[model samples]
Target: MEFLEAFFGVIGDLTWGWALIPFLVVIGVFFTVVSGFVQLQYFGRMFRVLSSKNQSGDPNAISARAALLLSVGGRVGGGNIAGVAVAISLGGPGAIFWMWAIALVGMATSLIECSLAQLFKRSEGDGTYRGGPARSIIHGLGADYRWLAIIYSVCLIASFAFGFNAFQGNTVAGAAEESLGISRIWTGILLTGVTGLIVFGGIQRIAKVADVIVPIMAVGYIAMSLVVIALNITEVPGLIYSIVTNAFGFEEVVGGGMGAALAQGLRRGLFSNEAGLGSAPNVAATADVRHPISQGITQSFSVFIDTMIICTCTAFIILLSDVYQPGAEGVDGIVLTQQSLASHLGGWTSYFLTGAILLFAFSSIIYNYYLGENALTFMTSSPLALQGLRIAVMALVFIGATAPSATSVFFFSDPMMGILAVVNLLALMMLFPTAKRILNDFRAQIKAGVDRPVLNPDQFPDLDLDRTAWTGKIRENG
Candidate 1:
């Protein structure tokens, strides 16, 4: 067991090493440029489409708003709060700056990836929407890449069932154990019950719950952050200055340092928003929006909210409290943030963080489960096989909650995430022309005030547009 742990630890460091941070930043910036800054052009349209019903004659899937909620629910959980705290602990206040930069660049990454997922999305019985890296891989890379799709599915499921879900559950359990004196066992069992109840109900049910919970939790958390920030308003200027100066390793930064600040910022920022990771796109693929760009734009905003708003809020709360020190001993993860909050807010913080952990951790499981389930659809056709997969996922959730260290689990997950991002990025790059064409076409129609917009995929036959783009369009032959 020790040997295996050491091995995975090395692998995790190898996969998540400093080098990958620059590479990810480059990729994000590159896509943003190629997309003609679609993040800005379609920003307003995204919110408009998300709010208004799709009147474009498409079969009803879940509304775009629900899709946005579900995507936020998936990405914005424990990572936003605890993860931000972890970043600050390791990377320092400057990490917040890196996170903001990544989110800005990641807006493009989010747009392109979600747009590709939108294009390849498949409709099963009852107008259900299903598409992700699997479909995009198969469609863009051809049937030959189906094997890669299977590999991706397996890795994704493994990461979720074993790595993501377990780590999330562990956070919840550990938080409860420390804060409320609730036994970790009870917390784990309770979490498993809550997760199982929602996950078993499938995506539609998950979407409904996210639609309600995500906004409420997000607003409440953000509101709390605002109050804290207001109380420490005097520290705001110095904090912001330190974050920006250290972010670029500027000479003006304290302690005569640049490299450490830059490294910490990039690493924490990437970990926080997970923009180039291709995880949230899976959820974005499920929304019933009019155009692919609509979902893409909404996803871009989601990235902003996750990192810029929520994660940054966590950063402020910690910095304002002044309880965090760069080399602080015996502090990490949720505990570090908990200490900062408690220093100013008192013992009640323990309960607040525990509740936040529950919300963030459980939501992560739902999103993780959905990603795995989608992956499994490509792995096998047998109903029995699928049922077994579900059971295995639940079992892993239990095991994961009690696992010794989430570090080992992340070693496996981080690599898979990198590979998945690369595969998905390749497809999105190839599909760029189609995405741009769709965007231009949609804009034209919207500007013309066409009550019923019809997007003919045949207009761009060279792209071999996938069925997901067709939505509810009925072919003449059919």
Candidate 2:
């Protein structure tokens, strides 16, 4: 076990620490430029698309709003609270600035990947749509490269379904144990039970729960941050200055300088928003929106909310309170955030944060499960296989809660996620022309006075899309 852990740790460090981070930033910038700054051009259209109603009466298909919340559930989680604190502690306050930069370019990456997912989406017999990096690879790239899709599916299942859930469970259990004096075993059991309940019911149940929980948790957390910032209004300008300066090697307080800031910020930012990781595309493809690009636009909004809004809230709470100690041992992850909040609000804020972390982590756990299930479906349709996977996931959640450390789990999972991201990014690059074409078509309709741009598949004769799924045309509403 030790040897395997160390081996995976080396792979993770090499993949993420050295290779993936730079590649992610470069691709993100490339997509941002090639997409004609879609994130900036269509920022308002994102919200408008979120408010648009479903174009089809497909019962299994989720509305665009529900899909947005589902993706938000997956995006906003432990990474927002614990992960942001980790970035700041390791990389200094400047890391937060890089996080913002990555997210800005990542918004364009998200738009491209999600639009491709929708473009290549396959319709199931049950009236649901299914698509993602795996599906897109198979359909868009051709059957000869189906093996690549299979590899992606397997890696996604391992990273999200099994590995990520364990990490989330560990964080939640550790937080509860520290704050409430609860036993890790009991916390694990409860988490396992609740996760099993939601995941067993599948995507619809997951979507329903996300819709209710995401808004409340996001608003409540942001509201708390607003209060904290208001209280420390005098320090706001200096704090912002430090974040910007340190990001560029100007701040002496940063330990490893700008390099550390860039690495940690990009790592945690990708973990939080998952913009180009291809995970959210699974949920984005499920939405029954009028135009594929509409869901893509909505997903871009999700990245903004995850990193820009929720992650910034965590950054402010820690930086404003003066509780963060850079280069200090044992002050990195969730502990830093909890202690900082307690310093400002009260001792009782620890318990409040534990509850918030519970919601945040559990939402992510189920969302991860859905991503894995989608991957499983791509690999094999065996009911027994899925059932076994569910049981295995629940068991891991229990084990993770009781486990002393999440180091090995994360070490293994991080590299797997790196692999998933690379594969998805490569596929997106290959399918760039198709995505750009769809974007142009959608824009043309908007220019023609169409309030809600409807997709007409007849315009794209070269594409092999499921025509029935895009048959319903939504006209402009006067």
Candidate 3:
């Protein structure tokens, strides 16, 4: 067991260490520049597109709002709460500054990758749209790179479906056990049943559930944080100053140096928002929109909500309370967060946090399943194979909840996610020219005074796309 832990530990460090971190940052920055800072240029358009009605009448398609919620379900999870506390514990308050930095650049990366997903999206026989990093690679990069697609699909399945579900289950079970005095076994059983019921209904069920739950939980948690910040309004200026100064090594409140602070911030930020990691594009491809860039802009807003709004709320709650002992032992992860909240609001808030975590974790479990299901469909269209995968995922969720420790799970999943990021980043870089062209085309239409940009596939004859997908546009001739 020790040997296994050590093996995964080394792999996690190497995969997420200096080499890959710089690569991710550079790609994010490169896309931001090449796309003419689309994140900034289209910031308002993101909200406009997200709130607009579905432009396609495809029954299997979802509204842009539904797609955004589904991606939000995946992006805003334990990472927003527990993960933020862990970052501050190791990196100090300054880490929040870097989190903001990565999120800004990552918006551009999200725009490019998600737009590509829409461009290469294929329709299943059932009318549902299917696309993501794997489909993007196969369609955008050509048949020769199918091997890379297969590799990405396999890693994505392992990371999100099996590994991430287990992690979420463990978190919920632990919170329940600690706060509610519930047995892990019972928690696991109940969670497994709930997960099975929703997942069996498929992506539409997941999307509907996310639409209702994500807003409540996110808003409720943020509202709580807002109250805390409101009460401590006087400390806001100093808190902001500390985050900035410590980020640049000007302050040494925490024991670790500036390098550790930067590394931890970037790692946790990427884990939370997952902008360049190629995960959200799976859901982004399912949106029914007039232009591919519409969904891309909508998803860029998701990154902001996840890292900036939700994650910042968590950071503020911790930083505002006195429970955040940067160099202290036994204060980390979810416990650190709960303690910080209780410090300000009283012990009853611990129960409130458990409920919040349950909602957050449950949404993430279903979102993770959809990602794996998409990968499975890409690999093979066999229903039996998918059923087998579903059963396996449910069983893993139960085991993860009842398991005593999640150390091994984190160690194993970290490297798998790293591989997914590397493969998807390479594909995005290769397909950037096509994505850039689509962006330019969308901009041209907007410049022509079109209220909602409509794509014309006839303009890009060389690209492989489903013609019918864009036929629903409200053109002047129609």
lDDT, model 1: 0.72
User: Which lDDT value does model 3 have at 342?
Assistant: 93
Go through the candidates in order and give the clash count of each: 0, 0, 0
lDDT of 1 by residue, 1-478 (tens): 7776677567556556544566678878987787677787766655564444442233445667777777787778777776777666666666777778788898888887787787778777565678877877787668888887777777777776557776777777777777788887777677777777877887788887887888877888888788888888898998898887766666333342555556666776676666767677778778755567667777888888888898888888888885777745455767777878888778787788778777877777888888887888777778787677667667666666666364354556766665665555566666667677777776787689953345666665665455554744632210
lDDT of 1 at 350: 72
Candidate 3 residues lying further than 4 Å off, grouped into runs, are: 1-11, 49-59, 406-410, 475-478
Tens digit of per-residue lDDT, candidate 3, span 75-182: 999999988998998888889999999999999999999999988898765756889999999988889999999999999999899999988888889889988999
Measured by lDDT, the strongest candidate is 3
Which of the two, 2 or 3, has more lDDT? 3
Identify the runs in model 1 with alpha carbons over 4 angstroms from their true place: 1-14, 49-60, 250-256, 402-411, 446-454, 463-478
**TM-score for each of the candidates:** 0.90, 0.94, 0.95
Assess each prediction's global lDDT (C-alpha) against the native: 0.72, 0.85, 0.87
Total clashes for model 1: 0
Q: In candidate 2, where is summed lDDT lowest over 10 consecutive residues?
A: 49-58
Q: Evaluate residue 318 in candidate 2 and report its C-alpha lDDT on the 0 to 100 scale.
A: 95
Give lDDT tens digits, candidate 2, residues 120-188: 888886767888999999888899889989988988998999898888888889888887899999999
